[model samples]
Target: MSDKSIRVAVNGYGVIGKRVADAVTRQDDMQLAGIADTSVDWRLRVANQRGYRVFAATPKAHTSMSKAGIVLSGNLDDLLDEADIVVDCTPKHVATGNVALFRKRGLRFIVQGGEPHALTEHSFVAESNFDSAVGRYETRIVSCNTTSIVRTLGALKRAGLLKKARGTLLRRATDPWESHQSGIMNTLVPEQSIPSHQGPDAQSVDPDFDVVTMAVKVPETLAHLHYWNVELSRAADREEVLAAFHSSTRIAMVRLDDGLTGINSVKELMADLKRPNDNLYEVALWEDLVTIQNNELFYAYMVDNQAIVIPETIDAIRALTGLSTDSQKSIAKTNAALGIGSALY
Candidate 1:
């Protein structure tokens, strides 16, 4: 919209896409160039209502969008031509096919977690590797669970207390809106393998991190809750461990004493706070539960699958664009715009 702002276009209008669109618009130095989507539904209409020009992602979608009464602004290439960078939020593996098209225009692009890390050969978590991705062609923002793991463990790693970590995750079966059509009930399903993909993915962001993860799909559609058993470098008091966690703004402490008994309650708390889309973009940990004894630390935290990566993606945008050279500066700007800090604790 102005000569000074970065033009950011979102290539999907689903859970992450729409949120990214809103976040790009809130920034003082970034502009929401437009959003491109193949869906010709209420989602597109909302983008239209919010004044984001809707571009059909395919020629077939172009005609259907008109028949569905969702006005279109040319096609995907048109949106790409106007954007300095594109965040591809299309469904899993779908973004891979678009890589050549983005390169044809020499545009910087970001792909979601469902994409493989090899797609960019660089995975990003704002706190972990923003500097490494600075002025790069692209990067992958690891999945929500991996983002939380990296944020929490990276804090400990930064404090010089981390040794290695083992984590167990209870994952939400599906997004809440689609829970009625999918997800398990009266049953729990576990990943067939130990030390799941999240463990290796965390390595993508920070190769020095020694972590292992196991996950299960639970019956609910609220959020993913993680239980961690970490070996610290030395025997430390709870205060020392908490002090390390306190250093990271993206890691928020929520207490059971505060009635946030689990993920659903945490989600309710975000809604009560009137956060946009009831988004909890931080790692909501139970400060009181964090305990360290004789070099072993145990704690648990909640991760909003749909929201945790939004800030990281924003930071990646700055990193790729060279708009902010320092991770803290870009993180601070993103946190301030998204309300991503400690007031809740």
Candidate 2:
């Protein structure tokens, strides 16, 4: 790796953007160039307190932000000029327009999964496609749900034990901060479809991988739970499947005895451990949930939606800057730097 640090910028300073900026700051080969956001809120204020160069995402927001006592470094163009690569963490559907801007400036960028599937050259999961992302101008990190799905399936596939997989995703209705948003309380809204878009989103990352998924939005902000039933080419016992997950670096096995018997318990564990943002980066799987019958494996795992993609975003920086070509090495570095896999739960 070169001695020079990669200058990285974040376009949005919302939920994911703040985490990405923090993750970038922790990396040895990357620096947080600045963050751009349209609004002047607690998120931007926190970015300022953390000593990040804050930029205005839109021209009109500048005057308002200045009025709100928040100092602005420059506009979006200036931020693009200063950054080696930008991670677009804008909310879902907001990044479509920014793609053309990045292309116009000839700047390499990483976008979140909320963007369209075709927005980038490829859908990136560091463990599955890190090498493919190197030297590419645009890389899209799959959504939190998609990340959980792909990691689970990818591990089984790598073991040559996966045939077909079907899952039900119990999604959180809103983020912890989005209490004012509709559907944040007292609801379990199902996505009235046989197979939700998340399965197809996962397939976009690996066309050969087969999975069918259904989703229901629950009124909790902790995590998204996935219940999967996978068919293997050959018969495998529960121990064998659990062993496969244990061998994988990105997957974390949770035992009942560990005091993480439920999703809320996992969150409490993060709080007790004093994890930043109470983040659990690894895919958390229940030890007792793994079962096998007639070559079919059934298991349940939880994905910390807000934290799952932070490491992937960090890996994207490595890929875009040609800093690291090996996914294992990149993952190890990120996990160690951010305390990802060290949590008790």
Candidate 3:
């Protein structure tokens, strides 16, 4: 760990951006340089009220934000000038346009999985590939579902048990806050493709594994649940499969027998625990439901789409700045800072 703190600025203040900013404040080794966003709404105002120095994402946004009576530190360029690294949480395809400026300033950066892996040339999952990102200019933190896949399956692979995996994801229809504006109700929309983007994206972080994923967008907006049927290298006992998942600190084993019957139930538990935003950072696996038949193991888990990648983004910051040389050490610090290690059930 570094004796000094690294500066981090968030370029977007929406769902993922706001969470990333709050997670940064919890870290002893990181300082929030500032936050930049295009909207002149309550979200940006909340960032300012929370004591984060806020910046307008564009000159037009600057003028509009200033006129809207929201206090501003400066524009986007000014915010980047004060930071060692910036985590781009802007919407998909939108952040790509901002890359030229980040590169011009010689700043190390991290972008959400909304952006392509080719954009950064390196992808990160704290436990799986922290060392690869060390002292690197930038990396992409894969999306929520992808992050969960990597962490869970990556755990099994490390234990020398994984052979091949297939999963189906039940994704929330939309973010809770945005449900009013858009979302399908009383219906289920499947991705219409086999081996969804998530499967390919996970392999970007570690290319050796064989994994395939399919997804459906559900009517609710609480979180995502994935059913996985994995073929182990050998016929392992149920305890052995649990042991593999236990190897990952970020995997929280929950029990269906405990009455945490669905994704909403697990999310409600997080709220009961008083987690900020009621965030469930770890992959909440159904411990009692993990089943084994011959050489195949089956289980299901919930992925908190909004909060899962926050810790990974934090770890990427430490790696890019060389703040810590060890991957486990970095993950431990992030987990501690974010209250991430405890099991909900």
Candidate 4:
């Protein structure tokens, strides 16, 4: 590895891509090499306005982007040439197709969790699998919901408190800005399957974890809420479980005084905090809602689908680059760099 900062490129400037690019710019040990996208939409313009070198996802998109009055720094080839690592946040299945391109360049890359686990060397959640991901060329940061589930369960597992876990995920229909996509308003669609893919996805991060997850898409766009029922191996008091979560740096405890009763309130809190892109990277745990009875724990937490994984992507960059092997150290550095800490009360 070079003594200089790692050059990181972000492909696909959608919701997650744009946030990753901004995060890369904030990191002390990483640089935003450039960003690539297929369209010349407002997102591309926003990237350009932020002074990032914008590259077309492909050579063919260059002509169309130029016609749309958007200038390009170079094509995808140029981005691969300059970046030490590429964070592919392209739509599902698109990053898989680009893997061969990165491999041909001898470049390390990170993919979002929307892609299947088979596409990457291993699935990653900085807090759960940071050590496993170190020095790995291909890493997939697990989905927002998966990250939330793993973090909560991982914490319980570490404390020898978890026996079996199950949850129902209330997912947002679409990203806040993606109004044109389906399921924007007046809907509560169940995922039509028992134990949605989230359970298996979480298992990919930690195969030993036994969890069953069901999901439903709601009309809100603020975030995804998870209601978890954790059966502990031994009897545990609410205070004991709360203390375990409190010990985790990635879990941000939200007290009632924080004025965060639900996802919208959490968004408002982020806005009030002046977070970049109103990002909420930590798993927002409702302090008041945490309950336990006869070794069974129940609680509700919110995951900002568009933001929670951003820090994990940064941690993956460090892991792939041999920057850090300690999950706590990497998480601390990433969190501090991104201004991710406890929520304002």
All models: lDDT? 0.92, 0.87, 0.92, 0.88
Query: TM-scores of the models, in the given order?
Result: 0.98, 0.96, 0.98, 0.97
lDDT of 1 by residue, 283-310 (tens): 9999889987678999999999999999
| Candidate 4 TM-score, C-alpha based | 0.97
- What stretches of model 2 exceed 4 Å from their correct place? 1-3, 342-345
Report the C-alpha lDDT of model 4 over 83-202, residue by residue, as the tens digit: 999999999889999999999988999999989998885999887889988898889989999998898999999888988999999988888777576565666899989899999999
True-vs-predicted CA distance for residue 19, candidate 4, Å: 0.5
- Taking the tens digit of each residue's C-alpha lDDT, what string does model 2 give over 23-123? 88888888888999988778778778878999988889888898887888999999999889999999898888899999998999988998887878599
Clash tally, candidates in order: 0, 0, 0, 0
Clashing residue pairs in candidate 4, if any? Answer: none
Q: Is candidate 3 or candidate 4 better by TM-score?
A: 3
Weakest lDDT window of 10 consecutive positions for candidate 2: 179-188
Measured by TM-score, how close is model 2 to the native structure? 0.96
